[model samples]
Target: MPISQAAQRLPDDAVYVRPRMAHYAAVSRQIMAALENISPSVEQASVDEAYLDVSGLERLIGPPETIGRQAKHIIKNTVGLTASAGIGPNRFIAKLASEYRKPDGLMVVHPHEVQAFLDPMPISALRGIGPRTAPALRQMGLERIVDVRQTDPALLERRLGLRLAQVILNQAHGRGSDEVQLHSVRQSISKETTFEQDIVDQARLRETLLWAAQEVGRTARREGLQGRTITLKIRLENFKTFTRQRKLPAPTDDDTVLYRQAWALYRESGLAEHPVRLLGLGLSDWQQDAPSQGDLFDTPSHPSEHAQTPQRDRRTRLFQTLDGISNKFGQNAITLGLRRKT
Candidate 1:
């Protein structure tokens, strides 16, 4: 659902959803080898569903059915998440097949069985056909795949636009997976704070964004990452949320960049008119970047991956200096990276 529409009707108390890319990243790497002879291409859709491409590996495993069985066993044994396998010509087919039989199911659809397999399924099985579209199709006696395929492709185009209609036709004909495009860099990094109660004040919101940006920048530094994209998201009292993003001329991990870009994106996110319960800021289009230099007079930095023993001693000396400062003054007297504000 669109954030604006959802917010208008949502209850006041719902926890925000977060995507744990790190966890899923680890899982994908771990699960990659399990899917037979395939060099898996995993896209984490959520914490749960993963999109994988397993073309042509079937021959090595004897057949698709056997490959699916072996894949399921390995995933269950290793990752601890029950997964379903979908086999088709492309990623689209694989993902749809997986969803059709979830919680440890395998679906294998050869090119020959595309229409026979799809025509009986509900229209919702097709991508981009949401609840609204399903009802619309049903109203037009086009609730199933065959109903949709039987309708003139041009006629469907008139109703849903040419690109989308053709997309539907391709899927009905058993060619569901779209083109594969590689992302060049990380899109964004964001942090959000969801308040227990809706906040009507402007001052508090600014403070929260400031804190969030600092934290986001800190993480960026830790990963040696920089991004050209900055995004701001806001959740209103009604359960609606909105997000906006901006692209920068150069990638950076600087706190100033995060603050300015996020500020601009926030203004565009449609949060101004509604009382907000949550605010999020993120950076995207990330590229690997060098770490920033610190205050030279305060601390001499050591390389993170320098010879293991030397690096350890350097870190210990740095910690000792920090401890001495804390002992003499106070915790507030010292700050670094994201530790400064949020």
Candidate 2:
């Protein structure tokens, strides 16, 4: 049901009817613990799903079916929530198997039956096949998963482009990577806000962009990371979203630099005439902050010297100081000059 419909259905005595992040996080921890007990090599697919490598544990835990049953039991016992389990030779098969018997059930696919199991399924059942791309596949007379294997690669490429065609073809063949990566590294940090009403004022939008940049910078610094690409996202009142990004010559955790790049991208978007419902800023292509080494061949007239002028260096130090003060007190303890009242 829609959120509005769900709210309407709520009883008069109900306290709240909404999603809760804290409760979700707590439940995720319980689920993770249950998976960890089954296998040390576990990859978290999402908040509600995970992949576990239990290849060598057959002797200790019986067959894959038994293990799946155990996992379901553990999750239910620990988290008080029923979970579906999928056992297969690879991640792709396992994912599909899980969905085959969802909401407290288990499905297992053997290695020999992989092709037979997948061939009968619709092309839309394959991963990465969404509403937009499904019609394109059907247009090419590729309706079933088996149709992709029969279709010419060049023809598929012409219809869906090369990368997507290759991916779909690979999945159709039941050839998927099964590596269960245990550790996940952080890739990007972002902040965004949706206004209560569409904002036509360019000044307010720019201010919101600045605020987003500040939040992203703060998070990046806290994580001891810097990024090369800065992205700006704008969502118009009509619900159309657009994004623009700029790649910096060097990674930076500076909020001012992030804001300037985001501002440039926002200007390039040409959305000033359009009322915006949402604004966002993001930083990616992360790099760790390493100590800089001075070059022995550095010259007084070098371009690098001009790039790091005394004024810019002072401003950088000032921002660093402001970050420190903000950390000591609170986020609202300091404000940039641009944010000050005239």
The candidate that wins on lDDT is: 2
- Please provide, for model 2 over 1-342, each residue's C-alpha lDDT reduced to its tens digit, 9 standing for 90 to 100: 632355467775545333553478569978997789989998887779999999999999999999999999999899889999998889999999999988788999999999899988999788889998999988888889989888899998888888998899999999898899987756788888777677998788778887887878887877788888888888776567788988877778878778777877877778878898778999999778732211212244655566455655676677678889988997778866454431
Q: Please give the lDDT score for candidate 2.
A: 0.81
Candidate 1 overall lDDT versus native = 0.67
Candidate 2 segments whose C-alpha is farther than 4 A from its true place: 1-34, 46-48, 60-62, 69-83, 128-142, 147-169, 184-187, 200-211, 222-224, 289-338
Residue by residue across 62-176, what tens digits does model 1's lDDT show?
6888777877777888878777888777777777788788767899988787678888988888888876667767777897888888998777888788887888888777774
Per-model C-alpha lDDT, please? 0.67, 0.81
What CA RMSD would candidate 1 show? 8.4
Error of 2 at 182 (Å): 3.0
TM-scores, each model vs. reference: 0.65, 0.67
